[model samples]
Target: MQGVPYLRLLGLVVALTVVTSVIMLIPDWNGEQASTAAPKIDQLLDVAIILSSFVFSVVMVMLGYSIHRWRARPGDESDGAPLHGNTRLEIAWTAIPTAIVLILAAYSWIVLDDMEATASNAMPVEVTGQQYAWSFEYPDENIQADELHVVKDRQVAVEMRALDVLHSFWVPEWRVKRDAVPGAPGSGIDDDFVVTPDRAGTFTLVCTELCGLGHATMRAPVVVHETQAEFDRWAAEQEPIPPEQPQPAAASSA
Candidate 1:
């Protein structure tokens, strides 16, 4: 009788697990990647989350079922089944959970190591965050601006910083978001990344941090150009077009 209950519980767990695991393949709504490296990382995380959801669902369902099936019936208020726990059941549960933990831990470590390892020697770009705006600094060109421009397939490392309050640089399409904190070193709050744009176009970089009252107004554009030459031309031409001298208002009515 005990074995039958355990089997039923296990079956319920498996069913719920499978259903939730399958749901993991669905795409995330806020996903983006500014570089090829980050998107792959995001995808891996999504997969892991799905797998975890499956496991979680299984555990939850089994727990719920056990509560319902083994609860004291209306007629029985006295002692239930004798307190003789199954050694095999206890060991199986412990061993299986230990094995899962070890496997997941190893997998997570490997993924982290791989992500941090450097890859292609793509050019780097410095992304600076301030109170109410973002500035993209090109290390090679010695220029900074309110907009960021990069070749579609090139690697870009955003060296981030906050002049005042904390700000998070987030680009949905590139799936890259990192905090820009005050007074850090090296890359500071900067996060290294790379992006290969499957489609070339302009995208918005919205500040994910709440710096101040004008936090909602802080935003920038990332222009992904088709070729390096095009990007160079655009970059060369980004100098401010001086504002025309102010003229007096047109003659008022006589």
Candidate 2:
């Protein structure tokens, strides 16, 4: 009888873990993994899901069993047995969770360190965010455009700043996000991050921050060229727009 309950609990846990893992992995939750760091991010998510499923299953099964096994009888109003805490069980639970947390923390630190490592020969692109639009500037080519274009399989270092208010640059496929804060005293001018796109495709770059009335429409197209020559060709075809010249102070009214 003693082993029967343990066997049932073990069966329940295995069943729950399998069902939960399938549900978690079946959905296209994180979307396409286009950047070099995206695969690592997705792996971390899977680890979290597996751990969470086991923890949830254990808690739920124990709680359900306790409620059913200790339920009061239909017409008997009597106090239940006064149970003292089990020191061994308490210590086991505490130690197990602490160990799990430490392991998770260490794994996460490794992933973060690798993701933030600087890449050599990264292409620089300046990004400006405003009330309702995003603009990109290629400093090397001296061209500004509404869309961002980069070479596939190359690292891109983005320097982003907000012209008016706060905004966030997020590309779902790239699995990276950074904030663009206004250039004020003590406030950072441009926040930067590097992303190496592994696939050549069109992605959407949207402002994840709520800045103003037109926040919902603050989005731009991101094009990842399959080859460096293709990107160079596109850049060569683009001409820099000249800055508008102001009239000579209305012919000096005074």
Give TM-scores for every candidate, taking all chains together and pairing residue i with residue i: 0.76, 0.86
lDDT of 1 at 171: 77
* Consecutive 10-residue window with the lowest summed lDDT within model 1: 245-254
lDDT of 2 by residue, 1-254 (tens): 13338779879988888788879888877999999999999999899888888888888888888788778889989897687877977998899788878988999999888988887878889898989999888887888789999999989988986777899999999999999887722354438889999999899998999999999999999999999999998898886845652323432323
lDDT, model 1, position 65? 70
TM-score of 1: 0.76
Predicted structure with the largest lDDT when compared to the true one: 2
Name model 1 segments beyond 4 Å from true: 27-34, 79-102, 117-121, 186-198, 240-254
Query: Per-residue CA lDDT of candidate 1, range 22-135, in tens?
Result: 676565644555555565667567666766775797669767877977888788879875877779878977987687778777877776666555547666787778779998
* Residue 192 lDDT (model 1): 53
Q: What local distance difference test score does each model get? A: 0.71, 0.85
Clashes of each: 12, 0
